[model samples]
Each structure stands twice: as structure tokens, then as C-alpha cells.
Target chain A: MSKPETPPAPSCSQLFWVFTRIALTSFGGGVSGWLLREFVQNRKWMTQEEFLNGLSISQALPGVNVKNMAVWIGYRLLGWRGAIVGFVGIIVPPAIIIVLLGTIFSSLSRYALTHVALTGAAAAAVGLSLSMGITAARAVPRKAVPIAIMAGTFIAVALLHWPLFWVVLAAGLVSVAYAYARAS
Target chain B: MSEIPHTSLLLSLLAVFAPLSLVTIGGGQSAIADINRQVVDVQWLSQAQFVDAFAISRMAPGPGSLLVTLIGWQVAGFWGAVVATLAIFGPTTFLIYAVAHMWSRNGGARWKRALETGLRPVAAGMILASTYVLLQAIDGGWFARAVALASTATLLLTKVNPLLLIGAGVVIFVGLHAISLA
Candidate 1:
């Protein structure tokens, strides 16, 4: 059941700081999980159902899911201004850090140990991607057609290395059509 | 020496990433393979440089797509970073924003539900596919694979922070390396 009273909308500055924190603190992905916790569980700016709907839309759309999500949450809370704040907050701060980190690491690149450490870190980081993937896969509907589409997509992109645009377009259209037909 | 044509270099960065921007479905991770080809195979950066940048992207905070920003910086200094960042993250901003706007309107329209439900599997698959590609590309051999797998299992079963896991990875690898030398 939903809360009886909605929480007051977050200020654009509040929204910006939240996204900036998520972008800055999230080391190994799962930014979406961070978003869910921040907005739904903590702030209660939006209900769980509302958050999930926006999440699905974020995942389905092109661009970074978290960035799309920041924009979505921003738009929902504070219209166009909120969206821009979300975008800049999520991107700008971290962009500077990455460039700084890159410069520092490139200088340290001569050491074999530097690479070994990064390699280990990178490997662990893959866990973020893999776990996120497994979570997403689990969210897919449990039907033969949808399952097959999911499998076909995995094979095309991972195994065969097909372009993602076409794969998504083809699979998305078919899946959407199937859902549409079954809906009516 | 001002050998590198500033305008053309910036334009080239834009050209490379702008179109890729629109096609980055299931998040920016999905674009890595093409990016590797364009940046490495096409000779913008050598394989060593590409690998370094890739590792930096993975290790860095924020979006993994910031890899493009790093590549641009390596290729063309400050301006390259700006252009590449815009190219990758710019075009799709409008599309998602518009959809979010449309989504705000109350609707139980059949097509809306269908669109949401239909895209789920595709997005799931793409995320998995990108993960697989990343696993293959990573270095450190079997050790890396094991760390990744353990980390994945830990993430799924527990609510432990991922930064801790990454730190453990660094400590473990360095420890193991020291022991090997001794």
C-alpha cells in the first residue's frame, strides 16, 4: 500500500547533491540500487511503484541507466530545472575526478605493481557489472517468448558481437508486439 | 608544436562519439566493444593506452562511459575531454527527457504497458551481454575471473559495500604477488 501523504518535493539543490553523492560514492556501479534506496526508502519522494516504473523506463531507453534515472527522478520531482540539475550533478563532479585519476594513474603506469593492483580492482569491479546483469535478467518476465528473446539477445551481442542498436531494435519491436498482442 | 589540428581533432572526437551516443542502449557499457575498435584498432591510441584508459574507467567513480572522456583527454587535452563527454552523453538526453515527460501524464494505455513490459527482456539481455564482454576483456588471467565471480556471488547474497570488495581485491592481489616473489 502507498503512503497516505506524499512527501514534499525535494529542492533542486537537494536533488543535485543527492545525485552528486551517488555519482561520487558509487565505486563499482549499482547506481540504480543507490537511487532506489535514496529516493524511495530514505527520502520517500516517490513511492516504490513509481520508482520501479521510472527504472524500467530508464533501462529501456538509450543512454546510461543511472543518468536516465537521475533525469527521470529530477523531472518527476522538479520539472525541467530538476532534470538539468540531475544531469550536471551526476556527470560533472565525477567527470573531473576521472580525468584527475587518469592523469595520476598514467604517470604511475610504469610500475608493474600499479597495473597488478588495477587489474585486481578491475576484476572485482566486473562483479558490479555481472551482479547488475544478473539482477536485470531476473527481472525479465518468465515466459517462453520473452525468455527466448532474452537468450537471442545475449547470443547476438555477446557471442556474435552484433551491433547493439539493431539487436535492441529487432528484439524490442518483437517483444513489444508480442506483449501488445497478448495485452488485447 | 601545434601539429595536431585543434578543430579537426575536436570535430573527430565529436564524430566518433555523437552517433554512438544514440545507440547506447541498456546503458553505456554496451558501447565498449565498438569504442575499443574505434580507439584501438583505428589507431587513435595504442593497445597499451587503450587498456590503461579502460582500467581507469572501470576503477573511476561515476559512469563507465567516462572512458570516452579519458580517451579524449589522452588524444586532445582539455577540449577533447569536453567534446567527447558531450558527444557520448548529449544526444540521448533529449530522448529520455521527452519520454519521462510523456510518462508523467497519467495513462493506463495498453501500448504504454506493452512498451514497458516488452523492453524488459531486451534490457536484461544487453546488460548481461555487456558484462560477458567485459569479463573476457579483463586481464589478470584466472585470478581476475575468480575475484569477479566471488564478488558477484557476494553482491547477490549480501548487502556488503562494493568499494570494500574492490579494496580487498587490491590487497589480496598485492599480497599474493609479494608471496610469489618471496
Candidate 2:
């Protein structure tokens, strides 16, 4: 299939810096949203439909959605080097910051307020997790089998204290198989 | 814990995170429960330390899965962080990259749709379960739980900045602490 290429891809360094800025500037959630704005809205690197297609695949596949989206976008534009640049740019800088923060907090671990502040932050962080859970739950189809699988997964992992690996494997296989059968 | 050799510690980090990488269906958040379980079992981090790492990861920018990196740093410093980060993120990079190559092709549309829709329920369940585990793991009493619930409500109901919510949480707790001290 011959494809027309218009406008050259950004240099690998440019791609790296773009991803780095996105990663460093993103606070709280919504990294994917930032990706959409930068790539589709501002840069016009890809169309909205193309980005959304990558977004869905990114979400469905195992891995972090934002990171997957980065790789997908990078690959779409610049091939292998772009993908590698995207992955490293998004992951490395903030990783160093996390370590630094962890060091600073560990030093202050002796203070009573340190624990208290962390506790507060953690409490709020749980909301982040819970909100994501609720959103995911709402997206599930309103049907019996899928709902049952979801409930069962919750039970096995949370209540029963079963190993998450086995629980995810079993539930995922069953659910995917069902969906596949239905689609046939 | 100190008696464990350096190479073994790195290897252990790999063993724990690499497998969990592929199974992280929805996101890195989905694997937290297992990460918590394994880290605790190995005595790499106490529950409190794990929770602290979780909070720090939340507060830090970039991917939340960097929680694994923080865990590694806490456990064995720089080398630990390096191993853990690579383990958690590396496996899935290959998986997603390969998929991206094939995704442009028109074949296997039905299977692709099935995989996407089928995984949604399981991902939802895992995320909720992880939330349940975290809610239980937190050390703060009712007040903390209340704050978490309030944050969740706020997030769902409004488009407020989560950083603001977290700051409010800190102020509320510290302020209440000051009153109790007085």
C-alpha cells in the first residue's frame, strides 16, 4: 500500500522534549487528555479519529494507558526511534523526581506531622483510585455475565484475598471468551 | 533484610513486577493490590511505608506506576529503583508496540473488538478491588476515610483540581491536629 507522506516528522529530540514537557507538567490524572490536546489540537500531528483509535487500543491492552498512547503516537509519526523516545521521555524525568521526593520524605519520617500529612495525601489518593474504579464500572456493559464477572473479580481479589494474577487471568479469559463468542 | 544479597534483591524485584506488568489490564493502578501483597510478603516494605509510597506516587507527576520505582528506591536505593522501573514498564512496552504495528491492518476486527469490550469488566472489577484494599490499608481512622470519601465525591461531581483536594485534605488533618493539641 503506497501512502502519501506530507510534512516531515519531528526530530527525535523534538519528540523527546514534547513528551518530557507533557509528563513533567501533568499533575494529578488526565495525562491522556494532555496528549490529545498537544498532538491533535495544537500540533495537528494526527487527526482526532486516529488518536482516539490509539486511545482505545491503549486502554484495552495491558500497560498504562498514557504510556501506551505515547508509544502509539510516537510510532505513528516516527517509527521505532520515536516509540523509544516517547517511552523514555515520559518515564525517566518524573521517575527521578519521585525518587528525590521519596528521599526527602524519608528524611522527614521522624516528624509526627510528616506521617499525618502523608496520611491525608493518601486519603485523597484513594479517591483517585475509587473515582477511576467507578468510571470503569460505569463503562461496563449493562448485562448479566459481564456484571457477574466484575463482581466475582472484586470478590476474589478484595474479599477472598486471592492472588490477583490468577483472578485476573481467569476472569479476563472468561470475559473475553464470552465476548468473542457473542461477536461470532 | 540486609542479609539478602544485592543481586538477589534486584532479581526479586524483577520477579515481582515483571509478571504483574502484563496483567496490569486497565492501568498500573490495577496491579497495586498484588504489588502490595508481594512487597509485604517479602518484607520489603511495611504497610505504612507502602501507603506512603502510594501517596508519594500520587503526588508526583508522570505515570502512577512509578510507585514501583519508589518502592524499589525505598528497598534498595538507586539500583532497586532501576530494576523495579524496568520490570514494571518494560514488558508491556513490547506488548503494546507489537500491537501497534498490527493495529493499522484491517484483519481481526472482531477479535480486537471482543478483546477491548471483554476486558472492560475485568478491568473495572480489578480497579474497584484495589480501591477496597487501599481503603483498608490506610492507617488513619474515620476522619481519613471521610476525607477519602469526600474526595471521591468531589471528583465525581465536579471538575475541580485534584491537587486542590489533596491540599485541603492536608490542611484539614493538620488543622484538626492542632486543635486536638491545644
Candidate 3:
């Protein structure tokens, strides 16, 4: 297959600054969608097709999707330098915010407002997590073996109270064997 | 600002980050189950404390997993939080960079596609498991259970902002408290 010629790379500094801006603003949900809108749709740094491809690759690889996506976007915009700047840019804001909050939070634990707010937020965390789970579940390919694995893992961890390590290890081994067997 | 011991802070940071970085194959929530083990079961933090940190993380702007910083702080202090947050994300960030670089170069290929196919279901399963574990940890009472169930329903049925739902839960809880309803 003929390799497509790479486009002119953006400067590392440009990539760094762009990602820094995005990281600063990407609070709460919708960060990924926002990145898609800005980088792919509006800026045309990468085509929609390329963005989707990159998203899948990022999700498959370890790490947060937003951070991974940032790295990929930076690399696409530049190269190795782009990757470093993008990673650092995405990570730094959250790190700083959490540290600051941590300091205040320890002191404010006795405050009524903080206590009530945290309790409520905990309830909502469950909802957010369930929503995430539902969304992820929809993405599972309609296959018997995979579905079975999903159900089994859920039951094992949720109902059986099996240690997570054992459950994950078993599922991983089974999935790998199944994939290899099918391939052969 | 009290000086946090660097060695204890560094050790705790590594203890939290090493397992979290390696095992968070799916993403933020996927790390929760392991985090529960390390933080709660290991007595690094109590279950309620974990809930508090998680709540704060959810309410705050940024990645959900960024709550790890708060957990780090609880284990050590300000510097500990910073170190743990950095350590947790550092290797994973580099790994993502390397993988993204190779992936862009290769473009769409069979192996990549196969990996995606395998990982998607696994990630889904991990998310479900994490949700279950969280629900168990937050086992309060009928009121709490009702709130959780209602919140889950609202999330599934409506497009309301999560922060708003969180606010509603707080209002209801406070109302109950004020009225001497426990």
C-alpha cells in the first residue's frame, strides 16, 4: 500500500498552547465532544474520519480517552514534540486543581455545606456511573461470547463479590484464548 | 503550609499510582474497583472517605479520575497529592503518546481493529463492575437507595445536567434533615 504523504506539521509550541487552552476549559463532561468540534469539525486539523479512527485507537490503548486523544491530536498536528506538549497540557490543569481542592477539602470536612454537598454529589456519582455504563454497554458488539463474558464478569464482581483481580484475570485469559482460537 | 515528608509521600504516591496506571486499561471508572481495594480495603481511606473524595471529584471540573489527587492528599498531604497525581498519570501519558504515535503511522489495520473489538467489551464490563462496587460502598439506607435509584432513572430517561441532579439530591437530603426526618 502506498503511504500517504504527511502534511506540514504544526510547531510544537503551537500544539502545546492549543492543548493548554483546551485543557483549561475542559471541565466536567463533553471534553471529548468539544475536542471533536474544535479540532476536527471547526479547525480541520484532522478530518472526521481521522478523528474517529484516532478515538478508537486511543480508547483501545491504556489511559484516559481525553488525554490519549490529546496526544494523538498533538502528534497529528506536529509529531513527537506535539505528543509531549499535548500530554503535559492536558494533565497539568487537573493536577493543580485537585491539589488545591484537596488542601481546602481536608479543612472543610466539618462544614455543613460541604458535607451536604458531598453527600448529594455521591448520590449523583452513582447516576453518572450508571449512565456511563449504559453508554458503554450499547457499544458492545452483538456477539454471544463477548456478551456472555460481560454478564459473567458483572455477576462475578457484583453479586459473587469475587476479588477483582481474579475476575479480571479470568476474563482476560478467556477472551484471549477465545480470540486466538477463532483466529486459528 | 506544613512540610509533607517526601519519602512517605513518594512511597504512597507510587503505591497508588503504580497499580492504578497499569490496571486502568479501560479508563477512569475502570480504576475504581482496584482503587477500592487499595484505598478502602487496605485501610488507606475509609469507604465514606472514598465516597467524599469521589463526590468532590465528580462535582469539580476536570477528569473524574483526577479525584486520585484528593485520595493522595488524604494519604499524605498537599505535596503528596501533587506527587501521586503526577505519578499516576505520568507513565500512562507517555504510554498513550507512544501508542498514538504508532497508531497514526499505521492508520487503520487489522490488529488494531481486533484489539479495539476485544477491548470494547472488556471496558464495558469493567465499568459495570465499578458501578456495582460503588453502589455497595454507598449502602446507606432506604432514602439513599431511593435517591440513587431515582438518579439512575433520571440519567437514563432525561438529558438533565448531572450537577443539577446532584443539587436535587442535596436539597432532598437537607430537607429531610431540617424536618427532623433523619
Candidate 4:
């Protein structure tokens, strides 16, 4: 199969800088939305179809979805060097900032106001998470089998407090197997 | 607290997080519970500290999984933070590369469709579950919960910037507290 060559491919540094910008500026979640707008819309380095495919696979695979996506997008555009840049760019800069912020917040943790402010910040953050959850919930097919699988997964992890590994394994296997069988 | 050797802490942080990487199934967030359990069970940090770390990561720019880096820093120091970042993100790097390689090579293959189609609902469920866990652990009582709901509504309804909403939350909470005092 001939690859649809993307003109004006990004170099490792370009990939790093682009991903770094996305990582730093993307806050309160929706990193994927940011990625789409940057790479597909503004840059045109990758098409929308290609980007969405990478996102789906990224979400399906293990590890951080956004991190996985960076690698997938990088690999699609620039091969080996691009992949390395994606991994480093996404993980390193953010890790540094988080550690620094952790330091600052630790000092502030002593104050009642810090706790209060952080509480408000956190409350708002939880809203982002909840909204995301609502979006995810709405995405599921209304079919009974899929709905049941979704509910079962929620119960095992959220309510029963089963270990994530077992729950993912059992649920993922059953769901994937069902999908494969249905497709066949 | 027993003084764990530097090497021992690094190795254990690597051990705990590396394996969790594979089972991260949907995304980094899905592993939060096991992370919570293992870190606490291993006596690396207290529950309150972990909750604080979660909040800091959520507020910080970048992926929320940076909580691991903060955890590592709290547990040991700079090197610990580096090691933890590598541990969590490093392990899955190759797996994704290989999958991406094959995915682009194969294009719309059976397993690809199966993996994509099959995992969608599972991913959604895990995300929802993580949100549930976070809600259960949050502080500030009903006010926080209400703040969360209003934030959700605003996100769903308006195109308002999330950073602004977060700032608004801070103001609302502080304002309400002042009114109570008066």
C-alpha cells in the first residue's frame, strides 16, 4: 500500500517543539482536541482522517492515551526520529513542570488559603473530569451487550474495587472477542 | 518510617509503575486506583499526600499522569521523579511504536478494527470510573461537588475557557466563605 506522503514533514526538533507547545498549553484536559487543531487544522502535516485513526488506536492501547497518540502521530509523519521526539517531548517537559509545581504547592500547603484555593481549583478540575466522563458515557452504543460491558467495567473498577489489571483483562478480552466474532 | 535506600526506592518505583503501564489499558488515568493502592500499601506516601499530588497534577499543564512524577519527587527527589517518569511512560513506548508500525502497515485489518471497536466502550467505562473515584476522594464537601457540577454544566453548555472556570471556582469559594463570616 502506498503511503499518502505528507509534504513538508517535521524534523525531530519541530516535532518536539510542536508537541511541547501542545503539552504546555493544553490544560484542564482535552489534549486530543488541541492536537487535532494543531496538527490537522493549522499545520496540515497530517490529515484529519489519519489523526483520528491515531487517536482511536492510542485510546485502545495501553499507557497514556495522549502519550501514545504523540508517538503514533510522530511515527506517521517522520519515522524513527519522530517517534523518539514524541516520547521525550510529551513526557519530559511536563514532568519537570509538575515537579516544580509540586515544590511550590508543597510550601503553600501549610497555609489555609492554599488549601482553600487548591480545593476550588481541584473542584473545578473534577468538573472537567466529570464532563469528560459524561462525553465518554454518551459515546457508547446503546446496544445491550455493549452497555452491559460498560456497566460491568464501571462496577468492577469503581464500586467493587477490583484490581484494574484483572478488570481490564477480563473486560477487554470479552469485549474484543465479541467484536471480532461479530465482525467475522 | 524506615529509611529505604535510594536504589531500593528507585527500583521499587520502577517496578510498581512499569507493570502498571501495560495494564493502563485505556489511558494513564485508568491506572489511578492501582497506583493509589500500591503506593499506599507500599507505604511510600499517605492518602492525604496522594490526594494532594492528584490535585497538583490536574492543575498542572500536561497530562494528569504527571502525578507519578510528583509522587516520585515526594518519595525521593529529582532522580526519583525522572525515574518515575521513565518508568510509567518508557515501558509503553515500544509497544505503541510496534502497534503504530503495524497499524499503518496493515490499515483497517481485522485485529485493528477489533481492537478499536472492542475497546471503545471499555475505555469509556474506565474513564467514568476514574471520575467516580476522584469524586469520592475530593474535599470541600458539598460546595466542591456543586462547583464540580456547575463546571460540568458550563463545559457542556458554554465555550468558556476551562482555566477561567477554574479561576471562577476559586473566587466563588472564597466569596462564599466571606459571606458566611459576615
* RMSD list, candidates in order: 2.9, 2.6, 3.3, 2.9
For candidate 4, the docking band is: medium
- Please give, for residues B21-126, the per-residue lDDT of candidate 3 as tens digits: 6546567777777687677866878877888788777776667778787887778777767777776677677787777667656644656656676666777887
The true-versus-predicted C-alpha distance at residue B81 of model 2, in Å, is 0.4
Q: What's the chain B TM-score of candidate 1? A: 0.83
| Better structure of 3 and 4 per lDDT | 4
Best-matching candidate per TM-score: 2
**Ranking by lDDT, best first?**
2, 1, 4, 3
**Candidate 2 chain B: worst-modelled 10 consecutive residues by lDDT:** B1-10
Ranking by DockQ: 2, 4, 1, 3
* TM-score ranking, best first: 2, 4, 1, 3
lDDT of each: 0.84, 0.90, 0.73, 0.83
Q: How many residue pairs clash in each candidate?
A: 0, 0, 0, 0
Worst 10 residues of 4 chain A by lDDT: A1-10
Give per-residue CA lDDT, model 2, range A1-184, as digits (tens). 4443454568899899999999988777888889999888888788788899999989999998878889999999999998999999999999999999999999999999887888889898899999999999999999999999999999998899898888888999999999999998
Best model number under DockQ: 2
Error (Å) of candidate 1 at residue B172 is 2.6
Per-residue lDDT tens digits for candidate 3, residues A30-97, read 67787898776666677777888888877776677777788788877777777778887777776777
Give a tens-digit lDDT track for model 2, residues B59-165. Answer: 89999999999998888878888899999999999988998898897689789889999999999999999999999999778888999999999999998888888
**Model 2 chain A weakest lDDT span, ten residues long:** A1-10
- Measured with C-alpha atoms, the lDDT of residue A38 in candidate 4 is 88
Which residues of candidate 3, in runs, are more than 4 Å off? A1-14, A159-170, A176-184, B1-9
Which lDDT tens digits does candidate 4 get at residues A84-151? 89988888898889988999989987876776677777788778777877777787778888789889
